[model samples]
Target: MPDTEGHPEVNEIELVDVFAALADPLRLKVVRDLLAEPDGVERHCTSFGLPVSKSTRSHHFKVLREAGLIRQVDRGNSRMATLRRADLETRFPGLLSSLS
Candidate 1:
């Protein structure tokens, strides 16, 4: 399976990694907020208004992306993130729904 933006393939996504990533309250909030958005909607990172420093926010995003919980891409000067809802559902059914 091909990887996109360092995201794990659906088959490679592990429940442990996802749980670890979601363990962080800030990261979990990011996931929950993304879940609240309509499917396929992407939000700029800055839109979240995370209380952490810019680098800290970036770190949080990287963790989420690497955990296969989100798909992120660079857009101009900012990064945009979208929850990997379908992939999550395919890999672990009802996972995302339970988080919402």
Candidate 2:
């Protein structure tokens, strides 16, 4: 299980890793949904309504977190996720806009 602190630092984020993480449609949708939310809003992992198993959804979140695209933390029994918007913008300008 990975914690919020376990994610790669913004400076340590690599383009290839981010690209690979977003290569999956599910993973890309997760990021896009987060981006659509207002700033500072953290959504629970299960709220995505994805057509996949719990474990598969967890895997997608893991990939995004490891790629420095999202920050996730345990909130009660649910895992909350927020798009690392500022961090991503800092590391790769115009990237998020292009995705939207």
Candidate 3:
């Protein structure tokens, strides 16, 4: 099996965490934009164009990652962010769709 050490497994992701992560408007917008992407697409963190400062944007990404709402990877000189669609779908079917 793949490592689930540092990140949440599908079953470990809680609705509360998801809800909390989505509670912020900026974070919700990030998630919305991510979900709108083609499957497997990863956008650079800075490309999201969020109004927050670098530190705040970093914090948003961290919260989303910890809440199992997104997956972030360091690519070259920048971080890439992508929605954890598969895991989220498996854990909470129709949740993302309902949010749309």
Candidate 4:
């Protein structure tokens, strides 16, 4: 399958990586915000209101994507993000709920 924004393919998803990606305060908040959205909510990066530099924000998003916590796709002139909810839920049942 084609890679989606560098996220781990569904088969490659790992619990350890997901946990590590969520360990950071900022990243955890990012995930939380995404979770708060209605299912399939595609958000622009800046809409998160994260208190980080542009480069730092990009890095955080990269970490999350690499860890399979989120999937990003190009939308028009900007990139958008959405939580990888189903993949995460299947890999570790009820884990996302526990984070809230």
Candidate 5:
């Protein structure tokens, strides 16, 4: 099911993984904040109001990224996370619409 070359049906992703990634309140908040950040303000994982330890926060972000709920990129010294808005909309229509 990994998005490998052989997997021509990469778009046939499961809803369980996607739903699981968005299940957390903190993760939801992260997405909400990312949408609000100004055009160029790439929010780091730590910028989220996650009360857990850094390790836990990292875990949450990883889950979201792996499930395609968010995108993470490494900038100079920090990792930035942004919502995969269009992709998610195409894959699961009305998914983000209900959340917002």
Candidate 6:
């Protein structure tokens, strides 16, 4: 579903998957921090005092990304996460708005 600009169109992403991803307490905290962050000032992986080890933290982030709950991009040595607020709002209507 690439557009004329050669970018794959983001289709109608599922509500269940996104909600399920955020259902985890750790994942919910991750998304909440992302929502409050300013542009280019995303929360990093090391900042969260999650009880899990490094590998487990890696797994949660991966699930969040795959669920379309967050948009991730490499920033130097770490990956930055931004909550997909606008997209999720459109799909579920008032989902992030009410929660925020």
> Per-residue lDDT tens digits of candidate 2, residues 1-100?
3345669988888999999999999999988998899987999998889999988888888889999999998888878999999999999999999999
The TM-score of predicted model 3 comes to: 0.92
Question: Which whole-number lDDT from 0 to 100 does residue 35 have in model 1?
Answer: 89
- lDDT string, candidate 3, 10-29, tens digits: 78899998999999999999
Question: Mind giving the per-residue lDDT tens digits that candidate 5 earns over 14-86?
Answer: 5788788778888888777776765345678888879999899988888777777777778899988777777
> Please, what are the lDDT tens digits per residue for candidate 1 over residues 39-91?
99999998888999999999999999988999998888778999999999999
Give the poorly placed runs of model 3, Cα more than 4 Å off: 1-6
Ranking by lDDT: 1, 2, 4, 3, 5, 6
TM per prediction = 0.93, 0.93, 0.92, 0.93, 0.80, 0.78
Give all candidates' CA lDDT scores.
Answer: 0.91, 0.90, 0.86, 0.89, 0.74, 0.71
- Residue 27, candidate 2: Cα error in Å is 0.6
Residue 32 in candidate 2, Cα distance off native in Å: 0.8
* Winning candidate number (lDDT): 1
lDDT of 3: 0.86
Off by over 4 Å in 4: 1-4
Please give the RMSD to the true structure for each candidate, in Å: 1.4, 2.2, 2.3, 1.5, 3.7, 4.1
lDDT of 1: 0.91
Clash pairs, model 5 backbone: none
